[model samples]
Target: MIPLDRFSGHANLYAQYRIDYPPDLYNYLLSFVTERRAAWDCATGNGQVADVLANSFDQVDATDISETQLILAAKKPNIRYQLSQAEQTPFANQTFDLITVAQALHWFTIDAFHQEVRRVAKPGAILAEWGYGLVKLGSDLDAVLLDFYRNRVGPYWDPQRVHIDTSYANLPFPFADVQHNQFTIHRNWTLDRFLNYLRTWSAVRQYIHENEEDPVTDFGEQLKAHWGEGEREIRFPVFFRLGRVMDEPVQ
Candidate 1:
C-alpha cells in the first residue's frame, strides 16, 4: 500500500477529481441500519463517505492516517475527524452500529483492520467495504487513457495484495451472508476537470516525474487530439460489498 504521506501532495486534487459513490449505493447501505444509528467511517478520505453516512446516521465518526486529508475534511459539522490509522481505531468495543471503508480499504492490512472493526462494531452491525473500478469511456480516446493506466499505472499495484477484490467472501470480519452490488453513475466534466483527475493518480504522477514526461502536456494533447475537447459527461460502474457482522460471539 502506498503510504498516506504520498497522498498529502495530491489531497486537494483527489477530493475534486475522484468519483463519488452513487446515491443508490448509500441508500442500499442505509437500508440495513436503523434510523439514528452510530456509524464509523474508516479511512474516510476527505470525509466523502462520512458525509454520505451522516445523512443517515445520527453520529458519524471518521478517521484517517493522513492529517492533511483530515484537515481538508474537517468542514463537516456532523463528522468527527481523527488522525488515526485503520489498524488501530480509537474507539470503544462494540460501540458502532455500522463501519464503512470506501476506496481506501485496499490500502489497509486486512487482518488488523478487520480485527479493529470487529472490536469496535456492535453486535449485528454491518461492515460495508466498497470501491469503484476505473471509469470507462467508450471512445478510442478513452482507450488511450485506459492503456496508460493498465500499462503504466497498474504495474505498481501489488498482485499478491488480496484487498482489491470487491467481494466480501473470505474476509476476516465475523460476518455472514455477504452480498455485492454494481451500479453506474454519470458525471459531466470539462477537459480540465478530466485532466486534473488523471493527474491525481500517484502512479501516473510518478511515471511522469521519473521519465520527464509531463503528464499535463503530453496526456492533455493526446486526449484533445482524440476527443476534440469540450465539456462531456462519462458514465462509470461502481461496486459495493456489504456483509452483516454476526450477533454471536467470535469463535
Candidate 2:
C-alpha cells in the first residue's frame, strides 16, 4: 500500500503540476449553494479547488490530513487551511453550507468520512465529490504510455486501498436527489510541461524512486523516440458526482 505520508515531500510538484478543474465544474458546484455561505473543502491539496471555492462562498475552509499540503495552501488569501483528516474533521455539527471532496476521496476511510461529513454538513447541504483521469494523445506513442500505466503502475498500487467508487457510491448522506456530470478539458502542453505533469503522479514517482529507474532519463528517451520532441495537446475528462444530503428519512 502506498502510504499517505509520502505525499508530504512532493507537495510542491503536486501543487505545480496537477490539473485544475475547469470553470464549468465550479459553476455547477455553485448552483447547489445558492446562499453564498460557508463551504468546507475536504482534502484540499494545495488549495487549487479551494481557491475557486473562495470565489463562490463567503467563507471557505480547506482542510487536509497532510500538514505539508496545508502549508502550501496557506499562501492563498481568504482560504483557512486546517490540518484535519476527512475521517475526523474538527468542524462543528451542521456548520457548513456545502462540503466538497476533490481528487482525494479515494484516500479516505469511507465510514468515518461519511459520518464526519454528516456531522458537519447542514441538513440538505450538498456533498460533492469528483475524480479525474487523463488521456494521452491518441497515437501509437500514447499506447505505450497507456500500457505502462495499466500494466506497471496500476498493479503496484493497492487496488482496494486506492479505489474510490464505493466511497462515493455508498454515501451515507441520504440524498433525495443525485446528479452526475462529465466535463472535458484540453491541455496543450510543450514537451517539458507534459513530462513534468507525468512525473508528478505519485505512482510514477514511487516507481522511479523505488526501482532506481530514472524516469527523467528513460521515459524522456522513450517518449521522444516515439512521438518526437514538440508541443502536444491532450484532452482529459473529469467525472463529477453531486448529491444533496437527505433532509429526512424515506417513509
Candidate 3:
C-alpha cells in the first residue's frame, strides 16, 4: 500500500467526530475464543476497537503509527496504547487470543501485517477486521454524498479504499476463514452532527489542504435541504472478515 499520514492532520477531529463500533461487534468476536486472555487492536486509530476489546479481555494492546491519534485514544486501565505500525510491532510471538483491526486495515501493508499477526497471534486466535463504508441516509441525501465522495474528492482516496467500497470481500486474508452475518451500525443524528462526521474524512481533509476549499461546506446546503431540518437515522454498513490463525507458520 502507498504509505500516507492520513489522520495526524486532524487528530482532534478524528477523536471528536468518528463514530463508534457497534456494541455487539465485540460479542461476535468473543464467541470464537475459549479464553479472554488478551487482544491486540492493530491500526487502532483512537483505540476505537481496543476500547471495546478492553471490556472483555484481561488485557488489550492497541497500536497505531500516529502518536497524535494515540494520544486522543480513550484511556482505560486494561488497555495499553503503543505507537507502532501494523506491519511491525513490539509484542512477542504467539501472545494474543484475539486481534482486531477496525476501519484502519485499508491503510496497512496487508501481507506484512498478516505476517505480524501470525507471529503475535496464538494458535486458533480469532482475527477479525471490519470497516464501515459510506453511510446510507436514503436516496436523496445519499446521491449528494456519493457525488462528493466519488466525483469531488474521489481522486484523493488511497487505492486500499476499494477494499472498503466492496466491503472487504477481496481483501487478502491469509488464515483459516470463518463466516459471520452482515452487520450495520445505526445512529440518529442531526444534520450538523452528520456534517461534523463528514468533515473527519481523510479525503475531505486532503481536499481542503490541496484546493483550499471545503467541499462539504458547499454540500451542506444540499444535505440540509434533503435532510429536512431534523434528526435522521443513519445506517453505517459494516463489512467484516473473520478467520482463525493456524498453528503452522504463514510461510
Candidate 4:
C-alpha cells in the first residue's frame, strides 16, 4: 500500500484561502466530456473541483485519502465525498464520463494511476489534470513571495512539486492528447488572505515541522509592512493537460 501523506491538517487553510478554479476552466474541460452523467474527481482536496463538477454532471464522486480534508469540504446533494487514493481506488471499470485531478496529480503514482484511469474511464471519456504555479502580485511583493517559496521552504517541498513548477509538461499521461486553451485562477484577496493561502503550502508545513519555526511569521511581517493593510488582485497561471481515454485498456 502506498503511504498516505496527510494534508488534512492544512485543509482549513486550503478551503478558506485557496482560490477555486474559474468557471471557464470547467467549461473548457466539459467540452471534451461527451456525457454529463457521472464524473470522478480523484484526490479531490476539499472537493474544490468536485463542487464545480456537480453543477455540470448528474453525479460526481469526489475521493481523497485524507478524511480531515473531506470533513472541511462543503456538502452538496449531488456530491459524494469518500476517502480513497488516486493510484488505487475501488471504482469499477468504465464507470465515469470524466476524470479530473486538480493540483494533486503530481502526488499520485503516475503509472499505477494511469492504469486505474484506463480501467475507470469509458472510451473517449475526457481526463483532465491541472495545477497552478507562482502567483503574480506586483513586482516588490512578488519578489518577497518568491524568496519565501524558493529559498525559505524550497527543500521541504516534495520532489513531485517539480511537476507543478514545470507545469506538468513532463508528466507521463497515458491518453489521447486534447489541445486546450489557457486557464488562470484570478481573484482578489486581502494580504491576510493571501498569506493564509501560503501557509497551506505543503513545503511551508514541512518547514514548520523540521525547524519548529513558522516561516510565515517573518514573511507575513515583511509583507504587511511593505504592502500596508489592503486587498489586491492575484492571478495564478494554471497549467492544465487534457486528454481522452483510449477505448482499449493497456494490459
Q: Which candidate is the best by TM-score?
A: 3
State the lDDT of candidate 2 residue by residue for 109-151, as single tens digits: 7667777777888888888988776565767667777766666
For candidate 4, write residues 102-161 as lDDT tens digits. 888888888889889989988888889888898998776788788878898998998888
lDDT of 3 by residue, 1-251 (tens): 43566998899988998999776776776888887899998888888778877888899999888899999999999999998888888999999999988898878778898888999999889889888989999866778778989999899777878988988777677678666556888999888888889898888888899999998888888777678778999999988878899975443
Which candidate has the top score in lDDT? 3
Off by over 4 Å in 4: 248-251
lDDT of each: 0.74, 0.74, 0.85, 0.84
TM-score of each: 0.88, 0.88, 0.95, 0.94
Two-way lDDT contest, 2 vs 3, winner: 3
Give, for candidate 3, the lowest lDDT window spanning 10 residues.
173-182
Model 3 residue 135 lDDT score: 90
RMSD in Å for all candidates: 2.8, 2.9, 1.7, 1.8
Please give the distance, in angstroms, between residue 133's alpha carbon in candidate 3 and its true position after superposition.
1.1
Question: What lDDT tens digits, residue by residue, belong to model 1 across residues 1-251?
Answer: 54444467778877777777788888888888763568999988888888877877778999888777888874556778888888886799988989999877667778778878778888778888877666766676667877776765666444422344434345555467677888888888877888788787767666665777755667677677655567777777676777777755344
Instruction: Provide backbone clash counts, one per model.
Output: 0, 1, 0, 0
